[model samples]
Target chain A: MALIEVEKHEVEEEQKPEPVRVRGLPFFPHFLLREVVVMCLIAGGLIMLASIYPAGLLKPADPFDTPSPIYPEWYFLYVFGFLKFWTWDLGPIPAKMIGVTVPMVLWYGLLILVPFIDRNPSSDIRKRKVAVTLGVIVLIGILYFTYFSIVHH
Target chain B: MTLNDKIYKWLDDRFKLSELLPPIVKHPAPLNVVSNPLYCLGGTAFLCFLILVITGIFLAMYYKPTPAEAYKSVEHIMTAVPMGSLIRSVHHWAANTMIAAVMLHMMRIYFMGAYKKPRELNWVVGISLLLITTTFGFSGYLLPWDQLAFWATKIGTGIAGSIPVIGGYISLILVGGNDIGAETLTRFFAIHVMILPIAIATLLGLHFMMVRIQGISGRL
Candidate 1:
C-alpha cells in the first residue's frame, strides 16, 4: 500500500507542465502578413484584370495559312525548343510527341511515386544534392536547348 | 438581474467571443500560423493569388480584349492611362514571377517530403491546380492579342489537338472550330473569366482543407 502511494506521487510530479520550445506561432518562425498579403493580391488581381480583353474573334482556322514558326507559351519554351530537331522536316511528328508527351509522362510518374522513392524525411532539399542537382541540371539543359533553338532560327 | 442570471450572462458572452475570435487566442502570429509544412505550400500559393488579384484589377481598367481594340487598348493604357506602363510591366513581370514561384513551391513540397502518405491526394489536386494555373496563363497570354500572344496561342491550341482521346473535340472547343475566330476568342474568354476561375477557387479551397487537417509534416 505504501509503495502504491509513492508511485502515485511520482506520477503527479511528472504531470507538471513542461516548457515547450515555441514562441509566437507554432508553425511560422517569423510571420509577415503584409508581404504575404501583397503577394496574394498581386497574383489574384493579375488574373482577374487580364481576364477582360482578348482579340474578340479569331479568323477561321485555316490549314493552308499556317501560323509560321508556331511556338508554345514562354514557360513551355524549354520543351517546345525540341521542335527544331524535326524542323529539318524530317521527323516533326516524333519530335513533337517527344517534346511534349515524354516529359509530361516522366514527370507525372516521378511525382506519383516520389513519396515511396524519397524515404528519408529531410527539410533541406539541397542536402539531397544528387537528386536536386540532377533536377537543376535537367532544367538548365532544357532552358539551354530553348535558347539554342531560338538563336539558330 | 439576479446573481445567478448575471453569472450565466457573463459566461455566455465570454464563450461567444472565444468562439468568434479563436485565432487571436490560438495564433497571434501570422508566420507561426503559415509556417506549418503542410499549410506553407498552399498558404504561399494563396499569397500569390492575392498578388494576382491586385495587379489584375489595376490592369483591368485599361484592358480591352477585342482584336481591333486589343493592341489599341493596350496602347491607350500605356500612353493615356496614369501609370499605365507600370501597371502593364508589373502585370507581365508578376505573371512570370507567379509561375516561377509556384514551381518552386511544388519543388519545396517535393523535397521537404510533404507530399507523402495521406497527402498524396492533395498532391494530385495540387497538380491539377498547377495545370489550371498554366492554362490561365496561356489564355491570358492571348488576351493581349499581340503578334507574340496570337501566334503562341495558335500553336498552343494546335498542340491540344495531338492528345489521343478527345483531342479533336478539345481543339474545336478551344478555337470554336479548327480555325481561330470570334467564337474561339469568346470561348477562351469564357474559360479564362468564368469557368477556370471558379474551378481554381474550388480546388484551392479543398486543397487548403486537406493541408490544415493533415498538419505540417516533420522536418528532418
Candidate 2:
C-alpha cells in the first residue's frame, strides 16, 4: 500500500509543470559589479577620513588621577545612561545590579529571543504592526539613552 | 593557447575548476537585492572588517602589549614609523565604521522581518557577531594605555562587575586582576588580536555558509 502511494506521488510529480526560476542577475559580473563599486566608495571614504582626521593619542595613563567625565565607547554609552537613569531598588535586587543586568544581559537576551517571540510568519511591514512598533520603541529608547549619557557626561 | 588559457587549463586539469566554476559563476542573486542599496549594509561591515584586519596586522607589528611600553609604542607608531599614523588612523576609523555598519545591518534585518522562521538561527549568529564586534572595540580601546583608555576601561569594568551573580567572574576574567594593569593589557591584547578574531572568523564562515545554503530571505 505504501509503495503504491509512493509510486502515485511520483507519477503526480512527473505530470506537474516545471518550476519557474527566480528572476535575477547572475552572480558573476552583473552582481559583482555593484559590489565592487560599493566597496570602492567605502574604501575611498575611509582613506579620506583617515587623512583628514587621524586617530588621537592622549596623555599616558595615571592610575592615581582619575579623569572626570570619563565614558565608555559610544556603543556602550546607552548602558552607562541606563545605569544612571535606573535608581530605584526592586525588593531585594539592588538598583545597580538591575541597571547592569537590564542593559547588558536582559537586552541581549530579548534580542536573541526576537525570532522566537514574534511568530507572526509575515515579512510585510504593514502586516507586522506589533513587531514594528516594539522595534521602533526599542530603537528610540536606545537613542534617547545614548543622548542622555552624552549630555550628563 | 595564450598564457591565460594555458594557466586555466593546467589548473582545471589539476583541480577540476571547469566543473566547480559554473555553479558559483552562474548563481543568480535576486533582482531586488541587486538593485537595492539596503542589502549592502552587511557587505559594508565585511569590507570594514577586511580593512581592519589588514591595518591591524601592521599596527600589531609595532604594538607593545605591556602596560609600561604600550603608550610609548603607540606614540612611536604614530610619530616615528613610516605611514604608521595613516595605518593606525585607518584601523581606528574602520573599527568604528564596522560597528556602525553592524548596528545598521541589524536594524535593516529587524525592520524588514528578515529574521523570520527559517532564518532564526542565522539571526542568533548575527547577534553573536554583534556582541563579538563590540567586545572587539572594548578590548582594543584599552591598548593605547592613555588616560582616556585607562579611565574608560575602569568604569567599563566597574559596570560589568556590578551585575548580579556572575559579574565578579566576568570582571576578573576580563581584567585578569583586581584592576586594569599589565595582566589586563595582555589579556585584552590576546582577546583583541587573537581569540576574538578566531571566533568571529568561524562565526562569519558559518553565517555566510548558512546564507548560501538558505539563500537570501525573499521578502522586501
Candidate 3:
C-alpha cells in the first residue's frame, strides 16, 4: 500500500511542473519592440532596393519567337538542373521521368518524412551526428544544382 | 473613472476581457528566441508576405489578365500609374525575399530538429507553405506575359507535363487547352490572385495556431 502511494506521489510530482514555461520577457512590449525594429529595417532595405533596381519589363510575348537560354525562377533552378544532370534511364523508365520524379516528388517526400524518419528524440546538435551530416549533404546538393542550372543556362 | 477605465469595464462586462486579457498579455516569449537573429527568419518571411499583399493589390487594381492586354497593362502599371513603379518593384523584391527567408527558416528548423516529437504536423504544414510560396512565384512569373515570362513558363509547364501518368492531365488543367493562350493567362492570374492567397492564409493560420499550442522549440 505504501509503495503504491509513493508511486502515485512521484507521478504527481513529474506532472506538476510545465517544462516549457520558462520565465522570459513579456511578449507584448519587450519582444514586439525588437520585432518592430527588425521589421522597419527590412522594410527600409526593400524600399531602397526597389528604388535602386526597379523591376524590368521585357518585350511582349511572341509565340513564333522563342527566346534562347530560357530559365524558370531562381527557386526552381534545381529542377531544371537535376533534369539536365540525370540523363540515364533506369531500365524501362525514361530519363525525363526519373529526373522529374526524383527532385519534385522524392525530395519533398523525404522532407515531409523527416521527423518520422529520424526517430531520434534528441534536439541537441552534438548528439544528432547523422541527421546533421545528411542535412549538410542535402543543402550542398541543392546549392550545387542551383549553381549548375545557372552556369549551364 | 477615466474614459479608458469606463471602456474596459463595459467591454469586460459583455466579453469577459478581464479574464481573457491577463494570460495573453503576460505570455512570455523565450529569451533566447527574442535575442537570436536566426529566429527572425519566419517573421521576415511574414513581413514580406504582408508587403507583397499590399503591393499585389495595388498592381492587380490595374492589371489585365488577357494576353492581348496583359503586357500592356503591366507596362501601364510601371510607367503610367502613380507610384506604380515603386509598388511593382517592391512586390518583386518582397516575393524574392520571402522565398529566401522561408528557405533559411526551414534550414534553421531542420538543424535544430524543431520538427521532432509533437511538432511534426507543423513541419508538414510548413513544407506545404514552402510549396505554396514557390507556386506563388511560378504563377506570378507568367503574369507580365513578356518574352521571358512566356518562354520560362513554357519550359516550366513542359517540365511539369513530363511527369509520367498524371503529367498530361496536370498540364492540360494548367494550360486549359493545347497551347498557352488567353486561357492560360487568365487561369494563372486567378491562381496567383485567388486560389493561392486563400490556401496560404488558411495554412498560415493553422501553422501559427500549432506553434502557439506547442510553443517555440527554442532549444539549441
Candidate 4:
C-alpha cells in the first residue's frame, strides 16, 4: 500500500507542468523606454504634419450663408450617415429622435453590455466567434457609412 | 548628507512625494501587453490630451469668447501671433489624434475581452470617458467660429434638440436660447475649457486607478 501511494505521488509530480516563463523586461526602464519612444514618435509626427500642412482658417461664420455641403468632422461622419439613411417618416416618433437615439443606444448598449454578453472565460479571438463577428461587422458598417457620407457630401 | 540627498530629504519632508510616487512609477506592467506596441493606445491618447491642454491654454490667452471677437481672435492667432499658427494647428491635430487613439484603445480592449468580469466598471468608465472626449471635440469645434464651426454646431445642437421629451430644453440650454448666438459661443467655450476638462480629468484618474488595481488584461 505504501509503495502504491509513493508511485501515485511520483506520477503526480511528473505530470506537473513547468512554470511559465513570461517574456518581457522590467517595468522601470524597459517598458518605460518603449513608452517614451512611442510618445516621441507621436510628437514628431504631429510636428511634421502641422508644419507641412498647417490647419486652415475657413471664412468667418455667417449664419446667413450656410456652406453647400456642410458636414461635421470625420469622427461624426458615422452618426451623420445614419441620420441621412434613416430619413423615413415616423408619425409619432420624431425622425431626428429615432435617427439619433437608436444608433446611440445600440452602439453604446453593445459597448456597455459587452462583458455580460460575452461570458466565456477565454480571451482568445478564435474561441470568441460571435463577439468577434459582431465587432467586425459594426466596425465595417461604421467605415462604410463614413465613406458613403464623405463621397455623397 | 550629500547635496542631492539633502535636497531630496528636504523636499520629501515638505511633500510626501517620495512615499507616494515610487510604487506607482515602478508598478510592473503585464509582460505580454507591454511587449506589444498596440497596447499603448490609451497612453498615447493621454499624451495627446496633454498636448491639447497645453496648446489650448496658449490659444486661450488670445481667444475671445464673444461671437464678435471669436473669429477675429482665431484669425489673429493664425496670421499674427508669432508661432500661433503652429500652436493652433497642433491643437487641432492633437484633438483629432486623441479621438482616434481613444477609439483604437477601446476597440483593442473590446477585442481582447479586457472588460470581462472584474473590469466591467472600468469599461463603463472608459465609455463615459469616450463620451466626454467626444463632447470635448464637439464643443471645441465651435470655438474657431468659422463657417464649418458655425453650421456644424447648428446641426449638432439640432440633433440634441431631437431628444424625445427634454430635447427642446436641452438644446435651449445648450444654445442658451432659440438660436446660436453670443450665448452659444460662450457656453461651448465654457464647456470645452472648463466643464469637460474637469469631468474628463476626474474620470481619467478613476480609469487609471482601476487599471492599476486590476493590472493590464492578458493578451489574446
Per-prediction TM-score to the true structure, in the order listed: 0.70, 0.95, 0.94, 0.89
**Regarding DockQ, does 2 or 4 come out ahead?**
2
Per-residue lDDT, model 4, residue A62, is: 97
- Which of the two candidates, 3 or 4, achieves a greater lDDT against the reference? 3
Candidate 4 per-residue lDDT, tens place, B108-203, comes to: 998888898789899999999998999999999999999999999999999878866777888998999988999999999999999999999999
The docking category that best describes candidate 2 is medium
Docking class of 1: incorrect
lDDT string, candidate 1, A1-153, tens digits: 011101112234557755443334421222444445645665556545544532222342343455666555567776566645434332545556555554454556676566667655454666677667766787677778778667655
Candidate 4 runs further than 4 Å off: A1-24, A89-96, B12-22
Against the reference, the lDDT scores of all candidates come to 0.63, 0.92, 0.91, 0.85
Candidate 3, residues A1-153, lDDT tens digits: the string is: 011101112334546743343557776666678789999999999999999999988999999998887878889999999998889999999998999988898899999899999999999999999999999999899899989988887
- Of the pair 3 and 4, which is ahead by DockQ? 3
Instruction: Name every residue pair that clashes in candidate 3.
Output: none
DockQ of candidates 1 onward, in order?
A: 0.19, 0.51, 0.50, 0.39
TM-score, cand. 2 vs. native: 0.95
> How many clashes would you count in candidate 2?
0
User: Model 3 Cα RMSD, Å?
Assistant: 5.8
Model 2 Cα lDDT, one tens digit per residue, B1-220: 8999999999999999999997787777877787688999999999999999999999999999998899999999999999999999999999999999999999999999999989999999999999999999999999999999999999999988888788899999999999789999999999999999999999999999999999898766
Off by over 4 Å in 3: A1-21
Better of 1 and 2 by lDDT: 2
